[model samples]
Target: MFRMIPPGLAEAARLTRQGRLKEATALLQGSLAGTRPKPTPARPATRGRIFEVDPATGDATPPGRAGFFSRAQGRPRPAPPLAMPEGARFLRGGFGAAQGERAWRLYIPASLPAGPVPLLVMLHGCTQTPEDFAAGTRMNALAEAEPRLVLYPEQSGTANAQRCWNWFQPGDQRRDQGEPALIAGMVRQVMRDHAVDPRRVHVAGLSAGGAAAAIMGESYPELFAAVGVHSGLACGAAQNLPSALAAMRQGGGTSTVLATARPTIVFHADQDRTVHPVNGDQVMARAGAAGLRAEVERGQVPGGHAFTRTRHSDTAGRVMLEQWLVHGGGHAWSGGDAAGSYTDPLGPDASRAMLDFFRRHG
Candidate 1:
């Protein structure tokens, strides 16, 4: 006679087949918590040297108990080189003014020729400086290849200790308020200082910064031609933990398209842990629901990641969405240079794609 198998047992069997027996077992044990404790991997104690550098003098402070690169143990490392392209310039400071805190950073491609040039704004994630983002994205390389000006707006740790974009907060998500205003202000400042082509401006970011890019596109449609979000979600679609979780699980929301001026969109994501892959689909869906013509194109890249492209159509032209869903990738920048943080240069080059998309719109 045949016997019935428990759901947990079946799940464990599936996980074992997929080489995720440990995770499967954990899930099974958690489901039956009262019966027995779940087994866990033994984590080794971490040990490393800590080095600190002063941003002003570019000098090392000294090391402490926490190994080098440990913020808690070391003084603070000197700000790394921005690795900007030749002729890049530092524009005005104080781009972001939120909650009595001031944010600042540099702008690249200092000199634009007689004709207007496309503008690309790069936002950094939590615990990151503008210099770090510039170095990581290596967008400067693309800026050099193409005639686009890149803007780097920094987030002060004093405002939020984590240096996150504050997209999760309601105040920062609204237009003409908090980080959104500051980011828009920066865009305006760049336009005023340089001959930036209004029709070709684009925005891109990583993690929390990615979420902020979506917010910028939602709030200031006329200001940005297209937006690139790497591993982030649409604003208002995720406000708190539960909403964020749901958005991550299901993807997409019903936010109106902000860019009446031009086609709005491009979203890149990895199917790995950390940020959910569904967020990419939700972004595309939101763009489509707003009457923006959307299309999805699929391909494969290095490191066994599947890349998808979703393009939105408008009067000006089609806005492209390129999602690089790395199979086992985590929260990191794809096709980034090794010198940058959390970058896997081996993956499809996102910077190149951003430039190509911007050029198409321009």
Candidate 2:
């Protein structure tokens, strides 16, 4: 029987079968970018059986006829809310003339009773969707709690099969080029539609998305209050594949040409396989040399999570820096939901740290 395979993967397999393993691996990795496995249902363990409870009294009873557990005795069932969280609306239509571009996802806090709230533009990693990022990072929940608007700009697979931001590509790395401009345009649209504080707009991302954030921060410093990079490198750190790989491994790079003096930045890295932790060091050093008074603080968190903060206070006395380095972690989001894609919740909660950092700076 003939087996069905994605064209991209089929090509990769053909290449590998022809003794082109390196080419095949690259193709496969790129194709798998930002992609995640479908979520599986959580099955209850058979070792321990769950019993039903009486609604009137706090007492357990034998399993019901359906053999399923119900509410405990005397406990009232929590009614579902009349409405979903405020500022959590899905826009299905496209934003501009960009064809095949779907509408951007926006998460606004209902508690923004005060006019003009802060906005955070969040970019997802390769092969990731806005919904996946929001679900994995739980940033929307934090937005609801803090009442800040979160913008998730998605990169379609059609743009790049890997679903990456193309930050490493020279053509797309410029100030007014490709996805960078698209992202900036999205920010402007959000600002115009909602009462967002112009001075408090910020940008952040993970991995490739983080690299894109660095590019945005370098090219468009005036448009953002701060930038956050998690498990990513500095912008323009490497000009080519060899240098890129070296920087990815050993870190250190040329200084950024950001016009501002030490813009607010938050850096997170994990000391483990895949991306190197030294990348964080390179980011801090580059930011510091750009005339920002960077204060460095290093520490570790639970579950072998460690971090270094390179803070620079702005004229408004707002504090920002890199944070949340997990010592023994892999290429994954820290403090994220375990059920979400490519995340390890064992470390310090990065979402909380990021929100707090954004709030403090913005």
> lDDT at 275 for candidate 1?
53
Candidate 1, residue 362: lDDT: 53
Backbone clash numbers for all candidates listed: 14, 16
| Candidate 2 per-residue C-alpha lDDT over 1-362 given as tens digits, one digit per residue, 9 for 90 to 100 | 54333345555444433334344445545554734233223232212111111212313222122111112212222222223464466453245544334357887666666788888888877545677677768887777777778898887645654355767567667877777778888888888888998878888888778888888887787898778887777888765443454455457366554454444454454543435777766665665534444566776675456655556655565554544456666666777774345466766677887777766665
Instruction: Give per-residue lDDT, candidate 2, residue 88.
Output: 60
Q: What's the lDDT for residue 188 in model 2?
A: 86
| Model 1 / residue 131 / CA error / Å | 0.9
Q: How far is 20's C-alpha from truth in model 1 (Å)?
A: 27
Off by over 4 Å in 2: 1-87, 97-103, 240-243, 256-260, 289-320
